[model samples]
Target: MSPDGLCAHRFRHTAITRLLRARVPLRSVQRYAGHSDPQTTLSYAQAFDADEAIADVEKLDY
Candidate 1:
């Protein structure tokens, strides 16, 4: 079950996002995600930016 509800697609999205955030190569993520097109894997990369931005901001201390 997903956080909100049971949805298999969410698992796919999360897995891809997590792999990207972990600095996994795009090709590896694509293969693991079973994506036929690199573009599909690239799309999941966007999900990681927000979290990365927050982490970067946290590193700054005023």
Candidate 2:
């Protein structure tokens, strides 16, 4: 369990989503995820679905 008592996977997704939300750069996420290149980590970001893109669009606040 996480510190917040949520599933550990939730934290994983949160981390990736947080990085995406911060516009931290996919290449940076790649390095952070210890991926050979940005592509691998990119797959993780899309592993669940296109939620990151959806979240970003929802944040438009328009």
Candidate 3:
């Protein structure tokens, strides 16, 4: 059990993150997360700051 009493839920979040990173369909992620609607799954997707992504990309030229 998690300190917040959401042990299983943490795994769900991790699964959702993995699916989002893999570019899986949002609808498919909704089904996997057992949400009745895609919007709910979409809410869990990581929010990317464009500036951060660009900075990270620039660092990859090593």
Candidate 4:
């Protein structure tokens, strides 16, 4: 992909991720992102949730 395409993709990704992280409802973010499938929006939410979950788990004491 071209550099411009990559930048645009990152912008989309970041926007969706930030919205999900902000506790915006999934359906609202999906509509704002123009995602045809709810799963597409869920994927971004899952990725962010998984990353935070891993980080929190790592801080656990034995």
Candidate 5:
């Protein structure tokens, strides 16, 4: 039994996040996630993009 509620929800979120981070195809991920809206899957991709952007900014000569 899950100590906290929505453990399966958390698992799905983590799985989707990891899949996105692994650069899986968006359409494929959407199918795996069963998301009707691609935007929902894209939202996870934005986080990965933002993280890479942050790393790039850190390398600035400033």
Candidate 6:
């Protein structure tokens, strides 16, 4: 039970993010997630950007 209550969408979001982070192909994730629009699945890419950006900054030699 989430503090915000049980919302199915939150689970969907978490699954999407996990799959993406695990390097699952976007098309495969779309099919697995049952999203009719590829664009909708692509939207999850933004969620990973912040983490990736942080990792990039950490890798800076300076």
Residue range 1-62, candidate 1, lDDT tens digits = 76779799888888888987887776677789897766677778785566664464354333
- The C-alpha lDDT values of all candidates are 0.72, 0.62, 0.66, 0.71, 0.70, 0.72
Better of 4 and 5 by lDDT: 4
> What TM-score number comes out for model 5?
0.62
Question: Which ranges of candidate 1 are over 4 A from the true structure?
Answer: 1-4, 48-62
Better of 3 and 6 by lDDT: 6
Q: Spell out the clash pairs found in candidate 5.
A: none
Ranking by lDDT: 1, 6, 4, 5, 3, 2
Q: For residues 1-62, write the lDDT of model 3, one tens digit per residue.
A: 96777887788888897886776765566678898855566666657455643443354323
Worst 10 residues of 3 by lDDT: 53-62
Q: Which numbered prediction scores highest in TM-score against the true structure?
A: 1
**Candidate 3 residue-wise lDDT at 26:** 57
Off by over 4 Å in 4: 1-6, 48-62
Ranking by TM-score: 1, 5, 4, 6, 3, 2
RMSD of 5: 8.8
> For each candidate, what TM-score against the reference?
0.63, 0.47, 0.60, 0.62, 0.62, 0.62
For each of the candidates, the C-alpha root-mean-square deviation to the true structure, in angstroms, is: 9.8, 8.8, 9.6, 8.9, 8.8, 9.1
Angstrom error of the Cα, residue 10, model 2: value is 3.1
- As a whole number from 0 to 100, the lDDT of residue 18 in candidate 6 is 87
Against the hidden true structure, what lDDT does model 3 obtain? 0.66
Off by over 4 Å in 3: 1-6, 48-62
Better of 1 and 4 by TM-score: 1
Tens-digit lDDT string for candidate 6 (18-60): 8878877666787898988666776777756766535533543
lDDT of 4 at 24: 77
For residue 53, model 4's alpha carbon misses the true position, in angstroms, by 12
Model 4 clash tally, residue pairs: 0
